[model samples]
Target: MVQKRISEAKEGKAEEPNLLQKILSMTVQERKDFWDKQFMKCIKCYGCIDVCPVKREEPEELSLSKWIEKAKVPPPYPAFHLLRAYQVWDTCILCGECEETCPAGIPLKTLQDITQFFSPEDVFELVPGLDKEIKDVILRFVDSKRTQFRRVTYGL
Candidate 1:
């Protein structure tokens, strides 16, 4: 079945709705509301994290895992989900087990599908205000570099 899907994808015969396309079609406010609703449904079960097969294995000194406070209900908005989402981006195999185990039926598979639409840098956009801040920082960096290049090339 997996091979058949791959062959169908290569032949452009796959009829499934593209997850990235669905997400991109939404307005910014819609995207925010979508994620907010999806994440708020989490019951702090940690099933998603538990089912992750390639969780970060870094030793203590090099560990960068954002520790989730399991005791809190709803797990403080996106923090809990964000950490898990980022961790699974490169590792998720699309097995759907996490979604199956989630008692609240939070679509772990669909949430993880955001990786297809976003790179790590743009992932911050899922949180309000962070997207604008990231854009500003990138613009400032680009402008500063352009100014430096002009000064060097044209002796401005």
Candidate 2:
């Protein structure tokens, strides 16, 4: 199943890379080691965050990985980094500015692309479950911020 999906993606038949193949291509240990090395090179310069279009709109109070770490333990429902990662699917222009600006040379563009493949639903599915409370909370937050923005402005 995974191999077929990867082949399909490579052939452009699939919209994105197979999530399972992306995960299986690297072992858990490999991922840990890769991230460990990348994290070591991070200077916390916020360049990546600044370049991230999603972060521009959302403006995370913390760095990307820090947000992920925090979301993993307590909240678990609305993982900001996970949402940001998937947002790359539509928002990423592939201009590669984030990768170029990274002091760590962590291949931010590739990572974002692959992660987006795995979780495209996160972009459209603001509320994964039918939990009305969670849905209402997200709707209120998003609508409040977006409702005032002009659909057309400055004759773009």
Candidate 3:
């Protein structure tokens, strides 16, 4: 099935739009509505959280997980989702396991892809002096101009 679609796309015979193009075409309000609907459907199963490999873990002094707050279902708008998104921004491998494990069918992969598309150089940029070593590495990367910014940092 997938090979046929790829062949048709190569031959310019595929009629359906790609997911990224479809997402990019949506108006801000439409995108918000779409995400809101999906988020509202979440049952707070924590499956995505469990499957995510990038979730931040504080040092031994602090709690095991400090990034994701323990909130109620429907998670007070985008807080839960955004926290998870940002926590995984730098390290997400796009493994699709989160989506696969989600019982609510929240389309975690699609949401994560959109987040990744917009992710900045450092996910903790706003937090001052968090990881100086990594920051120095990134600065070197940027100054060297060895590759495009996204390619160097994100492997895009």
Better of 2 and 3 by lDDT: 3
Ranking by TM-score: 3, 1, 2
**Sort order, lDDT high to low:** 3, 1, 2
**Candidate 1 per-residue C-alpha lDDT over 1-156 given as tens digits, one digit per residue, 9 for 90 to 100:** 544655565567887635444455456787778778877787776776676666665323212233445477776555556555544444567777877889888777766665434443444564433334434443343345447633212100
Tens digits of per-residue lDDT, candidate 2, 30-65, equal 655554455446554657667765544543322245
The residue pairs that clash in candidate 2, if any, are: none
| Model 1 deviation from the true structure expressed as Cα RMSD, one decimal place | 11.0
Model 3 gets an lDDT of 0.56
Per-candidate alpha-carbon RMSD to the true structure = 11.0, 9.3, 9.0
Q: Best lDDT goes to which candidate?
A: 3
For each candidate in turn, the TM-score is 0.59, 0.45, 0.59
Q: lDDT (CA) for every model shown?
A: 0.56, 0.47, 0.56
Cα lDDT, model 1, residue 57: 56
Q: Count the backbone clashes (under 3 Å) in each candidate.
A: 0, 0, 0
